[model samples]
Target: MEQLIQAIILGIIEGLTEFLPVSSTGHLILAGEWLGFVGESSKTFKIVIQLGAVLAVLVLYWSRFVSLAKDMLAWRFFRKGHLDALHIALALLPAVVLGFLLHGLIKQHLFGPEPVLYSLVAGGILMIIAERTKRRVTAEEMDDLSYRQALGIGCFQCLALWPGFSRSGSTISGGLLLGTSQKAAAEFTFIISVPIMLGASLLDLYESRDVLSSSDLPVFLVGLAASFIVAMLAVVTFINLIKRLRLTWFALYRFVLAAVFYFFVLM
Candidate 1:
């Protein structure tokens, strides 16, 4: 019963933070600490709930995703739609390569409260810097994104391999710095996130299979359902409101969250 409750709570946290500049992994770690849910299985649970959020993105962008998939399958490499597919792939490449290389090291060293808190603070500062120094918004929409810009954004996304340095935060900041507008950056961020996050979740599920049991299935299902439902709402709200929102505001929130966790939780 207690475990189920913790699962639901963590699921909500995952849903709320997954698409935002806030780090879902960081929040899950902190919440797990508070709820006494730390373990290999707990880590696995975090990754699994993230898939629920990824599912929300898929459902929300079903037509676009389907079109991208068709473009990929047909190898229509030079078509505009295929180019968009390539852009997402380029934006995912750097992180995917680096993450694959450093996966074990990152898991061993950075998946904890102390590292996460430091990353949260550092990521917040970076986001502010990106906003302040960003170039003029030349790319007003995702279709305006160039291959070079997409690759550059991917390089920035590598920062997210560090826990609490959020994937969305890194990518959106990268997009801003590369002259993309807020809405374009956010839409690109959301679209690009689906493949990588979904892949990572599946990989983690396979690797952590030894730790999970049939007994954990119900808890996992509950978390998955809660995360999916809440994530639908969160993503819709963000999309509707992002035009008027600023990354600096989210950055400030990250700063406060880090400080609070440091003083109250870590200390």
Candidate 2:
């Protein structure tokens, strides 16, 4: 019963923080520590629930994805109207390659409170700087992005491998600094998250297959379901809210969270 409650809490945390500039990984680490849920299985469970969040993106942007799929299937995805496929790939490439190379090292050394705390503080600073130094909005929509801009965002995404830095935060801030409008940057961020997070989740599940058991099924199911439902709501709300809410607010929130984490949790 206690474990199920913890699962639900963590699942909600994952959904809420996953797409936000705030880091879901950081929240989960602290939440798990508080709940006494630290273990190999706990880590696996956290990663697996991210799949539910990824599913939310697929559902929310089903038509867009279908269009991209149809274009790819027809071998026309590289044409003028279908550049999103290439853009997404460009935005994902650097992080994917770097993450693959550093995966084991990150899991071994950086998956801890101290690393997360430092990342949270550093990421917040980066977001603030991005906002202040943002250039004129050249890309009004994701489709307007140039390949170089997409790759630039991808390089920023490499920072997210440090756990609490946040993929959305890094990429969106990169977009802002690279001349993409706030809405466009956010749309690109959410869209690109799908493939990267889904792949990572699946990889984690595969590696942890030996430790998983039927007994853990209920907790996993509840967490996944909660994460999916909440993520759907969060994505929609965030999309609508991004226009009015500046990235600075989220950055400030990260600072507060980091301070609290250090004082209350780490102490």
Candidate 2 on 1-267: residue-level lDDT in tens?
Answer: 999999999999999999899899988887888889888889888878998899999999999888888877887646553346788888899989998888878877887888988999899999999999949888888778888888999899999989899988998899999998878888888888899998888888887889899889899989999899999999999888888998889989988988997899778
Computed on alpha carbons, the lDDT of every model, listed in order, comes to 0.87, 0.87
Error of 2 at 115 (Å): 0.8
The 10-residue segment with the lowest total lDDT in model 2: 75-84
Q: Candidate 2, 166: how far from true, in Å? A: 0.8
User: How well does candidate 2 match the true structure in TM-score terms?
Assistant: 0.96
| Tens-digit per-residue lDDT, 1-267, candidate 1 | 999999999999999999889899999988899899989999889888888899899999999888888877898544552336779878889999998898778877998999999998888988899889948787888888888888999999999889899998998888889998877878888888888888888888898888899999999999999999999999989877778888889989998998898899878
